[model samples]
Target: MTRLSSPAHLRQVRTGNMHAVLVAMLDGPASRAELAQRTGLTKATVASLVEPLLGQRILAEGAVVNAGRGRPSRPLRFAATGPVAIGAEINVRHLGVTVQRLDASTEFERRIEVDNCRATAADIVTRLADLIRTAIAACGRDPLGIGLAVPGIVQDGAVVHTPNVPSLNGIHLGDQLAAELGRPGTTVAVDNEANLAALAHVWPHRLAGDDFVYVSGDVGIGAGIVIGGAMFRGRSGFAGELGHVIIERTGHPCPCGSRGCVEQYAGLDAIFQAAGKRDLAALLLALDHGDPRALAAVETASAALGAALAALINICDIETVVLGGSYAALFDHIAPGVHTELDTGVLAATRRPIHLTTSAFGRAAVTRGAAALITRRHCLEPNLLLPPGRRQ
Candidate 1:
């Protein structure tokens, strides 16, 4: 790529190039020559970028290999102990916290099942704060930043309101957590649960597609959308409200002051009630036994889920849809019916078949997403995580 005339533009291009090089390294260890080929940068530019990284001990050289025809080269890999990030989440049925390294690997994670919706925000924050401390210590190093994912609409690190879980409404969770944790450097972030789910889909899971929708199913249904390798947060950052999408006009009433919404038909309660079972384990075992009642209930839930997803797919035109949370666990029992509806329901099914799959991260998706959100910057631009003097 050619540089612009202005120095500001030149710096921007170099930053972009630097980020590209770091992303290439994320795949695995490689020599400078290999990094040049992967990032499409000249050897000289790659060397210049590597200088600052090497000085900062962000990238370390491995044992030299003599297999090459021209010359021996030492493979360079991300330094494991330089810095890390802590990620945590609060959902209807659980709370979790985790620590992740700059190389996109989990250092440690802890999860607890609790009725967060019924608990007070202060109490939940206390427990989450404790977990965050535990996770930080578990990492065996200090964290550079921290992030959080919550089940409500978050704007500027505060919870506007949560319909399904009212206790979290009007909670400035981000500000409170930041004050509680007292970490500096402006890396803390607060976002919706499903958006974090989408972020997790990209990293740890490595789902193959730049654009896709992740549907979360626990106490309610949530959708996280990715567009152009980043989240599509709409004009007000309130996009991807998949749970409230209307499916039946005169059906059941929803907490959102809407009738016959997707959650009413596809949420955990709907499936459990349809199967005449209250617990998830019992329902899964019954389905494993090929029980007719369990199969029918799953079909009922899948049909509604597919119907809602058909609308999402038509509007978004994304071919990939991942079922996370409880939906992912039961995707096998529900995939067939969901596919049947998609085959007949979508406007362009023949052109692009909808690929339905389960969340590889499962229940732990949000926590990992929290960490990925912070460390992802380091993946793209290592300078983002380094101190000013150490950065290129």
Candidate 2:
């Protein structure tokens, strides 16, 4: 006689089936029959799985489609409006928020420039909370969760070390933001800004592959590594510290108390210092005018950046490198130098060419990436749509 399955086992199986159904629709709409075929589940089981999703407004019936011989069927698509995810960022120069639906459609977004380096952690949290509150009001619904991007090492929802924004050091930013918003129950995820920016490239049909390293260029440099379609946070969640990769044994000083780090040579500040530009806008204008000093500065930084990246690629075996943050703006000038360095530095370059590209989102990548983390979780675990007590 066959033994009955335990409740826990049954719940696990059901959750997997639901996830399959949702993932099958990522390309577009699908009927129950199509979903059954794609997910390897019976039509009846597919129907049972979709009912709650439809009822919860997570999925909606689209216009009927006819495949000539078979009966007409209405495809199921993600609802135009449903649970939304909020993404926020705390950068040295800006604070930002973005609200997005499960379909990846942005509902609300705002960014304000500020001298966050000088602001206290409490003041920054207050301003960011107000922005989140405004986004919630504009969306007219409570977000499913919030993802925060900060420029530093993050551990257990707290910012353990942020060299650029020291005020946030050792702060449980996620909990503080949630409490500031008076929604202590809301889930807030905090992570490295570069890591989140890298996620943004992967989810919602942005990046082409599962393995790559995203290097963020700014006042501080960081990298985000993606392998097999998921982030590789390494043990203790402090893996992608690209900025601190020592290129010189005794070069320039770093805020992290390290000397000759890559950031001292390739970070935006270094480039600006070399070019004598006050800011990114001025530097871009100079580059546009074919300014010799600006071009030279970019070349020097690119060489240093390439050396650091070559070492990372050698170890991680990542073939694609996407330059984000301020680097995106300087891509045209920097790519050649970086390519030259990679060709000579990477051992694997003899077998395969490394692909280097610029991020489409530019400075907006971190914020958008923060939002993607929430949407990704919602997609993989649709049970989150159910009431707290009812979720398996």
TM-score of 1: 0.91
Weakest 10 consecutive residues of candidate 2 by summed lDDT: 1-10
lDDT at 340, model 2: 96
Clashing pairs in 2: none
Using all chains and alpha carbons, the TM-scores for the candidates as numbered come to 0.91, 0.95
Q: Of the candidates shown, which would achieve the greatest lDDT relative to the real structure?
A: 2
For every model in order, what is the number of clashing pairs?
Answer: 0, 0
**lDDT for model 2, on a 0 to 1 scale?**
0.90
lDDT of 2 by residue, 67-124 (tens): 8899899999888777899999999888999998877778888999888998999999
RMSD of 1: 2.7
Model 1 agreement with the true structure over 66-87: per-residue lDDT tens digits = 8748689988998876678888
Deviation in Å, model 2, residue 22 alpha carbon = 1.5
Instruction: Give candidate 2 misplaced runs (Cα > 4 Å).
Output: 1-4, 204-206, 389-392
Any runs in candidate 1 off by more than 4 Å, and if so which? 1-14, 182-186, 203-206
For candidate 1, which ten residues in a row score worst on lDDT? 178-187
